[model samples]
Structures are given as C-alpha cells and as structure tokens.
Target: MATLTSVYADSTIVLGPLATEAQPEAYDLCEKHVNSFTAPRGWQIIRLATDFAPAPPSEDDLLALADAVREASRAPRPAPMPAEHRPRPGGVMPGPVTAPLPPPPEIAEGEVLRRGHLRVLKGDKE
Candidate 1:
C-alpha cells in the first residue's frame, strides 16, 4: 500500500509507497491502484521514496492512554454506612411523631363535583 496526496499550495501531487517510515503529509492508497495514478492536465506528479518498515507508536499516544486508565482507577467508591445508621430494608425510620389528622368532612351530594382524581366543593354561603 502507498499513499497519494495533492498539495494545493505547491500545485503538485505526490505518490508515496508505503514503508515502516511515516510521511505525515501523505495519504495511504491501496496497493492495487498504485500503478494507475493520474493527475489533472496541468498538475505535476512527485514520487516520494517509500520504506516498508512499520512506524513505532508515538510516546504521546502511549502516555495519553496510561493517564486515562489511571484517572478511571482513581474515581471515588461509595462508602458503606454502619448497619445501625442505615435505613431498614422495608421499614420506616423512628422519629418524633404526632397523631394523624382526621379525614376531610363528607361532601354533600349537590355541593361536590368530581373530575378525575380531583374534587371541588361549593363553599357554604354566609
């Protein structure tokens, strides 16, 4: 595999064969199409020296991956509360309690209007 790229600034196109060495500016092309390269009528084609060796991973890429893994490992884990202080699985907690309020007085037939779960009661005239 090789790469072919058009450099608009210099009005030139380059065909570079793939090598272990990396050329930052070149785009990779399929091996089958290397011999079929062409350019516009006025453009010039430049052939770059190609090396077949594989490029080594950059230091920055390795460091970034290590930093990401370290950060994920450092995330805070939730602390478990003591059994006595924790709420019972299905029971309410003990607290200062008062008598429950009585239910509302029954509504008279004509004075109450019901809609869905709501109720409207006519006020007693003074």
Candidate 2:
C-alpha cells in the first residue's frame, strides 16, 4: 500500500498504496484510484518508485521457524486415558455427584459500604 503524508511543503503526493502499518496521518489508496489521482493547482506531484513486491524472508525469520519446529517436536504429547476411566458420551461421570454450594447471605442495610464504583459488604463469617 501507498503512504500519504501531509507534512510536505511542495505537496508532492506519492501515488501508491500503503505497504505496512496504517498510520493515522497516512492515506491508503487503491491501484485504480492511485492512477486517477491528480494534484491541485500550484501544487506539484512527484511519483516515487511504486514497488509493492514483498522482500525475501530474512535469516531471522528462517531461524525462528526452525526453532519453532524443533520446540514443537520436543513437546510431549498427552497419553490417552484408559478406556475404563473415560467419561460417558452424555457427560455423565462414574463417581458420586456432589451438591452445589449455597448462595451467600444477604448484606445488612447499614453494613454495606460504597467506595467509587466498588462496594464492600460483610460476608458470612464461615
């Protein structure tokens, strides 16, 4: 993609699309619009090299990829659980089910305190 800057004094606009990060001050234009762009009166337009070809992968990129592959190969795969211990298809386990916990006790009228957007209230002692 082309990067458009407004800081130039001659108003020399680079007619191309932005190739990298989208900056707030830069304008990205498509190939069709770039060709049709025209400079205003008293302003000069300088056409810079519009090379959009991606650079070849650097040594660092190749090294990082190799390291990642080596790390992945070294990682231990989880052993499958025994068929006897596996859970049923319907999500039912083979053990005694425990009851859910009771809800917290209600806070007293004056015991509640507020600080900014947060509130502090006394909870059950246990």
Best by lDDT: 1
**TM-score quality measure for candidate 2:** 0.34
Model 1 quality (TM-score):
0.33
| Candidate 2, run of 10 with poorest lDDT | 97-106
Model 2 misplaced regions, further than 4 Å: 50-126
- Model 1, 1-126: lDDT tens digits are 667777988889987755446667767776556657788888998877554333567998799999999999999988998455434333465763344444445656765755435678788799
How many residue pairs clash in each candidate at the backbone level?
Answer: 6, 6
Best-matching candidate per TM-score: 2
lDDT of each: 0.68, 0.62
lDDT of 2 at 64: 94
Backbone clashes counted, model 2: 6
Residue pairs whose backbone atoms clash in candidate 2: 1-17, 1-18, 1-19, 2-16, 2-17, 2-18
All candidates' TM-scores?
0.33, 0.34
